[model samples]
Target: MNFKGILLFISLGSSFILSFFLYRQWSLTNWFDALFLIGLLLIMVYCVMVLIEGQFFTAFLKSTRNFFAKVNKKDQLIRESEKRSVEPLDYRKEFPNRSSFLQVGLFFCIGSLLISSALHYLN
Candidate 1:
């Protein structure tokens, strides 16, 4: 299978396994609860994946560095030094499959929600 398909399968399988363990060992009480928990977990994963895809951490670091440089009265020097340095690494080129996390997280979230809804309606 392709990377996206593999990611989706792994996410779905892991979510099921995790939810099953929670239902068995914790106070989940039912498959519905477990599925709901899986939905939440997958949603969190989706958000984190989105952040990563957006390069939020990189931007945050850049802003923090600027803030510190400004506080030190060396913003211009820092900017000039950065311009003279080698080009920053292209993360997308380095990790070409990283974007697949967004789709996998989304698919897992939606699947968990749908299953949980069905369980709710059936019971």
Candidate 2:
């Protein structure tokens, strides 16, 4: 696991515990609020990870600039060399393991909700 993945797991694990408590105390009265709070926490964790790694943020800015440059719709004479050359697309390079972090976080959130529901029923 990368640094981001580790951070995600830690945050999600703690959130799961907190969520369980909220579910027990509030009994679904604040389910949406809890979900929103957890989403914000996850976003904050991602922002911290981005700050620590730094590469993803820089790549995001670079890719945005490239996208705008390509989308300008300006007509220019194509050079022979540029016509012959093709840029390779590797999504992994652009995203930098973001999918895994999302997947793990999503799974943890769902699992926590289920567990909380089960506990509520069992009580």
Q: Which model scores highest in lDDT?
A: 1
What's the residue-level lDDT of 45 in candidate 2?
Answer: 59
Give per-residue lDDT, candidate 2, residue 72.
56
In candidate 1, which residue pairs clash?
Answer: none
User: In model 1, how large is the Cα lDDT of residue 115?
Assistant: 72
The superposed Cα distance between candidate 1 and the true structure at residue 45, in angstroms, equals 5.0
Compute the lDDT for candidate 2: 0.57
Superposing every Cα of model 1 onto the true structure, what RMSD results? 5.4
lDDT per prediction?
0.60, 0.57
**Candidate 2 lDDT, tens digit per residue, 5-118?**
686667655555666777765444255346546655565555666665655466676677667656654422242336642243333324366555555556556755776677
Per-residue C-alpha lDDT of model 1 across residues 12-121, encoded as one tens digit per residue: 56656776676565432354455445545555665676677677688676666656656774655776777753235444313466557655555555665677677668
Model 1 spans with C-alpha error above 4 angstroms: 25-55, 58-95
- Clash totals for all models, in order? 0, 0
Candidate 1 — what's its lDDT? 0.60
